[model samples]
Target: MIKHIVMWNVKGDTPEDKADGALRLKTAFEGLMGKIPGLLRMEVGVDISRVDYACDVVLYSEFDSHESLAAYAQHAEHLRVREELGHLRIARHQVDYPVTSLPVCAAAEAA
Candidate 1:
């Protein structure tokens, strides 16, 4: 499986506007499920920290494989979402990684 994660710093004229834009993006990303093949799961989060360095929104998605994730990147629906987001986002960060079953707490559990 492949895990794709992305974070964005949204742009707006005011904090309220930025908050609204973040909600719009969160809803749009969540709506992409089922429409796109290989998209096993999708989760969107909006930051409530109100901190200067906090990103406005984050997307966590899962795909069956690297090929599946690649297909999703080029999918028409996803492209449309990207186009919509282009206007609202000031900066973006993304990472894709292969999913593994190794337990992150294995050492702690052993102790």
Candidate 2:
């Protein structure tokens, strides 16, 4: 499996604005599930821990292979979301890796 992870840090005019913007971003990220194929699963959401994290949103997804994840990342809709929110985001981080094995905690559950 291929794992894709992304994080975003965004700021708005006000706290309420920040909240609204974050939700919109989440919606935009989740929209990919319907538009993209080869997706086994995907998730997008705000960081509830409220710790000293730079990103306000987190996206985690699994695909059958690296190519599919790359395609999904390059999809026009995905690019649109990136372009649309590029200005609102203060910072962004992305990581992709092959899943050789699930963590022990997750592996147990999978069984």
Candidate 3:
């Protein structure tokens, strides 16, 4: 499986505006669920820290493979979401990596 994570700093002049943008971003990305192939999971989160350095929103998603992730980048629905909300982002960061299995603590497994 492939893990795709993204974080964005939204563009807004005030705190309220930024919060609104973050909510819109969260809703937009969550809407992708069940709309694309090989998209096993999709999650969006809005930051609550309200700290100066925190990103406004974060996206966590899983794909079957690299090809699927690539396809998602070009999918019409994905593109449309980007076109609509792209301007609301002031900064974006992303990371993609392949994972076989998540590590579980021995104590947890014993329980």
TM-score of each: 0.90, 0.85, 0.92
lDDT of 1 by residue, 1-111 (tens): 999999999988998999999999999988898998889999999999989988999999999989999999899999999898789999999999996875579857876
What TM-score should be assigned to candidate 2? Answer: 0.85
Backbone clashes per model, in order?
A: 0, 0, 0
Error of 2 at 39 (Å): 1.7
Is candidate 2 or 3 superior in lDDT? 3
Looking at model 1, the pairs that clash are none
Q: Residue by residue across 1-111, what tens digits does model 3's lDDT show?
A: 999999999998999999999999999999999999999998899999989898989999999999999999999999999999999999999999998765577557877
Instruction: Please report, in order, the local distance difference test score of every candidate based on alpha carbons.
Output: 0.91, 0.84, 0.94
In angstroms, the error of model 1 at 68 is 0.6
Error of 3 at 19 (Å): 0.6
Candidate 2 on 3-111: residue-level lDDT in tens?
8888888788777777787898898888878778888888998876767655788888988998888898788988998899777788889898898987999999999
Model 1 misplaced stretches (Cα beyond 4 Å): 106-111
Following a full C-alpha superposition, what root-mean-square deviation does model 1 have from the true structure? 2.1
Looking at model 2, residue 69 earns an lDDT score of 86
Model 3: which ten-residue window has the lowest total lDDT?
Answer: 101-110
Candidate 1: residue 94 Cα off by (Å): 0.7
- CA RMSD of all predictions: 2.1, 2.0, 1.8
